[model samples]
Target: MPLGILEDNKLEHVPGTAPLNELGRLDLEIGQAIDRNILKHDSTGQIVLVPQPSDSPNDPYNWSRWKKELFTVVIAYGCGCVGAVGPLLTPAFVPLAEQFGVPLQRFTLGCNGSCIVAIAASSIFCNTLAVKIGKRPIYLATTLGLAVSCFWAAEVHSFGSLAGARTLQGFCMAPFEALIPASIADIWFVHERGFRAAIFNLGVLGGINLAGPIAGSVIQYGSYRIAMHGMGGAFVLMLLMVIFLMPESAYHRKGALNIDTGDKVIVTDKLSEASIEKSGVQEVKTSTTSIPSTEPPKSWTQELLPWSGYFDHVSFWRTLLRPFVVIASPVVMWATLLFTTCISWLVLISITLSQIFAAPPYNFSVSSVGATNVSSFVASLIGTLAAGPIIDGVVKMMSKRNRGIFEPEFRLPVMITYIVFTATGFFAWGESLYEQQPWPVPVIVCMGLINLGIQLGTSSVVTYVCDSHREQSAECFAIMNFIKNMFAFGLTFYVNDWILEQGVRNCFFVIGGITIGCALLTIPMYIWGKRARSFVFRYKLLDRVLKAP
Candidate 1:
């Protein structure tokens, strides 16, 4: 018998009637070897492994253009409703206070307290949950929950019930803040992320600011119950859009099956082939490989806790303790602090504007104060539209000059011009209030500039952090959100009291000074950002950089 011969569709030894001597055996082996060499084939053939493409049509990216746009719209709208609606409720403070037999300050606490909870919990849990269950479902669940809570709030008679409903609303809404960005990141590539994020940010800002007008209209034409009902309706529409149009972005979808044995293999769908090809464009075939687990798989309880892994990782604890480490990195710290201060100041202006317009000089009603938020909505739109492409262009230009190295600091140039405009706007606003200037002047100059500053500061800071800590952008952003909301929460509570005590003139002066100071800090950060990054990398303090989801 010769082992090399093919038989019955399988490789087999050739069988003869009898055993052979050494020379006979050698001859048979040679014959069999020749036959095997000429007729060789893989037992499984070519395997026909038509892997689901990375940018497969089935993937979120490869979805129809309408679908992507719809997803963007849904996310933006959902997030906008969550962020804006609650803050706008501030206008109803007096009524709420009277109804609950509580002080205005206590009413403010309900709103502000919810914001604090959102900031604290969102940063901790959003990324972890998105990584666990997935983004779309979380987005859907939270949005619907928010709507239900809104309805519950409308029906509540007691302060405790209202507060509890609002808290639940805030917690559910937290996912919108966290998941929208994650969703954007899932579908958009690095080059396109800025533009898409700009759209998302605009929705968030627009929705929040627009809430005033929307709420105002509801108050004037309808009851609080009516207003909440309308908000709930809007959320329901947003929910429907998500359920129908928002496909799972390829980044989150589980791996597809192996063609041969139908076993699953881990491979991320490629963005180009996955998203682009769905648009009827041709793309290259990509080889697939299994994804390696970087962190250990989590149990249900571990998954629920936002800071689960960190409890065990000493470095994580160290990282938590040294949030200022971001500040120490001239770029991260400076940008974060600058934007944080800028946002705080912008919020101050908004708070101040509301009081000024609604009180003595203007004598506008609560509804009017809420309606004035329309100015911010407009400014946010303009700022967001301008920011995306311009920021991307600046980064691209600088990256080219730097031999394709990208630094987060490239986004600062635009901030310079914005700061000037913002400062001028603040001064103009203060002067307008002092002189009791006509309505249009403050609206155009003061309100416009405040919002412009907000857009510039927010956009710049978000993009900077994402760029600075590529891997940990989600966590970094979570931390940034935590800091921002904490600042905002405190300011919202007291800015009114400050205005009452110091008078508008001193308050505006103080705000302007703070903004100018924060804007100045940008210079050192912009200058030293790259050098700082290099230093961090060299020292292997890169671990200190926030990791993305």
Candidate 2:
């Protein structure tokens, strides 16, 4: 028997199961009679591959595992570089403020706040273009722009000039948030994406946390200008990688209709009649013809071409507006709230760290302030490595309990850890700083807990959205990025003020309460999520928007 095929050939139907076509009802189960040849299967035959790969070897899904991993690393590095830029100057906030003859709040508003707004504003346009054209050119163009912006930052004499460069850098960085997740979905299967997405998120958090130390050391020893120049040089190297190493991952899976069989097995393009007969399979339900691609794979040089041909079939205006439509999704809204609250804490903690430690009881040096990020970096690494692989295992174990049927809600149990870690981290962090307990309490232990929660929450939310709304994953992510960044940008206007007014302990107490509330949303989501997906699908909400003028 084939790996995925059960010898008994009995199809078990679980009660209250939503239709297979419902948005979030993904049936990833073992022992399905899906023809392994027609639809891709994992090595264990434990699960049917989502968005089955085409025969053309150029499909990113068909690429060798090592090749996919290498490409992922290159992209992750770019994400890290972008992640680093926003905070590289954070360590020098005080000195930069003094040099520019401005207050810390005003300086942060110009530099960090403006950059976040830019990141929010630019994501929709960049994502639409990426979906319409190709990801390769966007990656190259934005990376090049980001590199130049870094060089510009190094030369800036005025606060205005620095803000301008940072704004440009933010615009370039926007694509990574939306595109990287989409690219991961394109390359990896559902079961494989948990860990892979973790890797990508790790790159981002790693870059962000680690950049603090590098910038601090540089600022302490030399100057912020040197740090800017070093960053520019780093981006230049990333650009070269984009040029020589990265291949276009934006392939249009044209005419691919994911027909959800009762078992939630995808009946891709064409089914094998002979195999179906041999397996004694009956009642195959499909609405579209399944045709395998026979096109020859592109040559190495061809793959290296920066621009793949335009995806003319993708309407630019429609793609641009799609995220707005997708924003209506309950799943997307929950994800935005969960993801925003989770990631914003990282930023909140980051921007405030220098201020808290630089003043009063701690009176830490600039380098010491930046050095504190090492704890976050180490904690993020540990959290990611621990959570990534385990996510897949948890899903598999739960699926087995459900008679091998998979629902996106299976991803939510991990959010419990997110709640515990984040709530505790916030409360502890604030109290530690307020009590002036030692540097290690807030900097090492508390910060570590917060970062750990961030890794868990971020990876789980991204993976969940992609799995739940696979077709609109790009649009969903685009809007989520926009909302989350906007949320962060808005916070900058008042974060410092709020901290001063409310005091660190109270501010964190409120934020910790909010964190718990956000994480608790997972409970309702786990219960009613499938029904909500069904209601949206049945109502044709997305279709109405897509067809509108």
Candidate 3:
């Protein structure tokens, strides 16, 4: 009686069917349990669903496409709004510097300080919490945190308070950053995830891109304090929207196969009863099946929960520490390295964006620098729109060609885009600024490529890592993110010095070289990622450690 058609009780046999293993003729009817089939049919109708959905309508995968897409749009929009708070202050740095009587560059520390909390929240605590409590709760709590932090940003009197507010805002941001990809895995089939993730990547990074312009206009009309007020107000509306619109994405469906064996496509679901007890649940409930069903067609009000059932059966400590165990995996390591390198370049640009454009041959006002990012915003949006579905379509094509077999590597060829555009963008942006060429060249063309590259890389790697460890996606993401934040957070502290000492031309050239080198790791991953995963799974303590028995 759940959404799709259920399997019939009786098995129908064909006419002239031979019994007792006596059939010599080919009557190849491998129609095994149609009800269980999560048929994500492609043009080449070799029916498959990666990891597959359960028979329950309560399963997120079974939700109506409208609900899933609506949730995604909200996620993209909310994440974009919240993330903008991070760098909106870039255009306002001069005003902030003057307000606090500090050097202009000192504000970079305030921006970077969020990296510290982001490391803790995203890499470990908040991401781990999302697995237990569910993403809706974390979303509400984090949105509230962003709201309060923004108001604090407006009122903060000293550099310390400003840094504290920014850091807290970053803390609020980490859960959204680390959780969205893993959460998308909840409702979307693997083939559909690329474009959806593009939406997410756009919101978070695009928010950062769009913020400069917003900050410029805000600062142009009023004070930097006004920008914080506006950002805070925006988050408040986002909070209300989430409370009404965002339903739970975390579903406790049993995996069809063991991820450790590499026997099937990896899919992570919330903890099962056996795993829950193993993870450390003291008392068991009669319905150890799942959290409250968002199914059965509830009233408008009943769809929302006062709070999610966080850690009722799952172990928080085990989930918190799981990232460390995952890092031991070479596949996860390479993905982490790729993400870190990509993020480093983005951060380098954000910290110095206003500084570069505000004072130079251009002599642009705060608003102009902000407007420069508009092209990046549009380009990245279009790129994500095009890139996501294109990759999804490619996966279907390749899967059909492979006789309906899907490999994680099917996504890697797409990352070739990352290598080409990301490398070129970094070199051109830096070189143009270094040479003082026509300003629009770097602002539009060069920066647009980097934005596109970053979005593409993000969608690919998140899919790669999440698909590989879907059985324990929280741990997988936490581990990859742990390393990613570590690299990005560490760089944030002293990137300014590195830029000042090296000069922008040499600085970007070096960073570009590093990214190109790291991007090549995708080669081995595409070719031998399964073997690498198998090697890690062989360790005696890997399960007990990472899965946390």
Q: Which should have the higher TM-score, number 2 or number 3?
A: 2
After TM-score superposition, what is the CA distance of residue 82 in candidate 3 from its true location, in Å? 2.5
Query: Backbone clashes in each candidate structure, one number apiece?
Result: 16, 2, 4
**Candidate 1 on 378-495: residue-level lDDT in tens?**
8888888888778777765654454333345666676775677777777777778878888888876677877776676667766665555543455455555667667877876777
Model 2, 378-421: lDDT tens digits are: 98899889776677777767665655556677777889879888
Q: Which prediction has the highest TM-score against the true structure?
A: 2
Ranked by TM-score, the better of candidates 1 and 3 is 3
lDDT of candidate model 2 versus the reference: 0.78
lDDT, candidate 3, 1-549, per-residue tens: 001112122223211111111123121221222221223333344444554455466667777888888889888889799668767877656656777888766666765656444645565788777767777888898889999998998987788888888878878877777777887887887777788878888898889889988888988888778998999999999998888878877866553322223322222245333422332422323344234434464455766884644343547787666777777777678888887777656766877776777776887887887788887788778778887677777766665554444556667778888989889999998899889999888898899988888888878887777666665666677666666666666766677677778878898898889988999878767766655555555553357755554
Could you tell me how far off, in angstroms, the CA of residue 383 lies in candidate 2 after the best superposition? 1.0
Sorting all predicted structures by TM-score, with the top scorer first, yields: 2, 3, 1
Pick the winner on TM-score between candidates 1 and 2.
2
The TM-score obtained by model 1 is 0.72
Candidate 3 residue 48 Cα shift, in angstroms, is: 1.6
Model 2 stretches astray by more than 4 angstroms: 1-38, 254-292, 310-312, 547-549
Task: Quantify all predictions' global Cα lDDT against the true fold.
Answer: 0.58, 0.78, 0.69
Name the lDDT value of residue 86 in candidate 2: 83
**C-alpha positional error of residue 416 in candidate 1 after TM-score superposition, expressed in Å:** 1.3
| Every model's TM-score | 0.72, 0.90, 0.84
